[model samples]
Target: MLQETSRDPVGVLVVEDDAVTRKALCLAIESDPGLKLLDAFDSVKPALDFLESSSPDVLMTDLGLPDGSGIDIIHACARRHPATDIMVVTMSSDEANVLACIEAGASGYVLKDAGKLDIARAVLDLRAGGAPMSPAIARMVLAKVRDNKKPAVPQSSPASDTTSLTRREAAILDLIAQGESYGEVAKMLSVSVGTVQTHIKNIYGKLSVHSRGEAVYEAHRRGLLQLGRPPGKRS
Candidate 1:
């Protein structure tokens, strides 16, 4: 029988292609009394299939899978299980990877080099609604923020024509850029998914953009979206 603990265990699904690493992660999660390992998968396909029928409270996934990228897993989970927290547990600490994962609605980012205890602590923090990042990852995020360039405005720029977004609208757009589905944004904002959809439509109309990618790109161009801060942090 699977070892069960008395405390309310946060069910977790582990997704990593490496057999040894996957087993080790599963062991670490099992050792923690606050986490319960619901399932482990070596590829995205099966993991997504399992998520459709069953739900886990947290998802710990690797960035590079043999079949698909971890971003795919994050996108799927955000749609299927909006309330499930996501953590990226991978070897790549590249700034691009970090930004991509966070944009994809991940609540935590931990490198594989993080010790078992660190991973456990990250999971716990994620469950508690805090964005967890390994020390190096956190530093990388800060560096990106520091290096960001301010958008330039022409000297004759008209204030009336300048695109202005409300705090909530900007927050919703940030999440949308980060790859969160409508359902996930709704849960995070405590609003109906229909409300999220309506906001997204209005955002597109204001920006003259048609798709999510376009909206994110436009927001970045306008300096409306910034790195380091989690989506919805402003409101």
Candidate 2:
């Protein structure tokens, strides 16, 4: 479906775990005359490996991956390939991950439900130095921006809940925010995966959030975590 052109097409690298979505994204890139997909991967490791050798023009990745969060990939690309433009194509539209990706250097944010044509155009727009976002994401970002302009609201948490986190729990939360899987964190800390899970569960309770994304958002909001640092420095 590629159209003939004298100029080289923009190179695109896709990282999506869902098979169907990955294929569709690849096809979308291929279908565009101005875009060429350099590679596609379903997990974080291979993508990181590929990035070590090749720098694509655009990186479209999901936030959730089998090995870790896509934010790690974004951080690597942003640091290693500063010229590359980062984009997020994920089912997660939550503010925490979205803002994290933005802070991590993703200039485009689109939902998976955005059709193939839109995906291709988004890549093009991204490469053209435009920030593209799904409508909902765009609106949410605008609202967040507006809210940021307002006076700071005093942060409060229920005293009954385990709101106070231990140093280890905060460390674990930071690692999770850095996209480390439980097993990876366990290996890094020399603990069992079960123990890591228990720590994460306790972190959730203490943060009053159920999921990793929420935990990260809450922790960041409360100044318990510093995100968007160099990969290892994130946690």
Candidate 3:
């Protein structure tokens, strides 16, 4: 894990094919005082070559590239720099590509149309071990989970619920299922973002979910989505 000191910003590596999109992503990440542009590449080979020597705290890549698929870069990061937070910023929302990225250890997925701020925010949230998937991407992932029929825990196992989470954990899981960001959840719960992250880590472990989308799906499968509702049920 890269340590964050007052002297260093969060290092970011961007890999996108489109020149305009690449420039936009670079500017968005660098514009933030919290993030430093480590490097930006338009192809997978160079990015992978660069990763051979260095590992940024965050690796953001698109799905398609001239030389090859961006999933290769994601796989390299997962193997070479396991601590790095990998996010997919691409136009492809196809189920196969999304599932491939997830299996390759991507932490988040944002569409190309998400705007610069959303991209930057997704990178930061991912670095903090919070899955920052866009709403549409989240939905796609949930669809796959349903199609697979692989529940987080077996339906016949009642003890799974009893030993799975504490009330606070359940509450945190609920908020996450509702698509609340870590920062938003922190403010709502009167806790620090780090605390929220810690809870998220625990949530991921208990639920066996790698991304926010999967966590939400698992929560629903386990009948915990209703618990995530806020007071006075607006619906």
Name the top TM-score candidate: 3
How good is model 2 by TM-score? Answer: 0.61
Candidate 2, 179: how far from true, in Å? 29
Candidates ranked by TM-score: 3, 1, 2
| lDDT over C-alpha atoms for residue 135 of model 2 | 83
Q: Please, what are the lDDT tens digits per residue for candidate 2 over residues 1-235? A: 1212227889999999999989988999999988998999999999999999999999999989999999999988877786687888999998999888877768778887755447787787666435677889888876775575434343665533335677667777767655565555676776776676688778766765534545665666666664344334433
Q: Can you tell me which runs of candidate 3 are displaced by over 4 Å?
A: 1-7, 114-117, 150-235
Whole-model lDDT, model 2: 0.75
Q: Which ten residues in a row have the lowest lDDT in candidate 1?
A: 152-161
Error of 1 at 67 (Å): 1.1
Worst 10 residues of 3 by lDDT: 226-235
> Tens digit of lDDT per residue, candidate 1, span 70-137?
98988888667766778888999988888877666676788877665466777876665356778898
Clashing pairs in 3: none
For each candidate in the order shown, give its overall lDDT on alpha carbons: 0.75, 0.75, 0.75
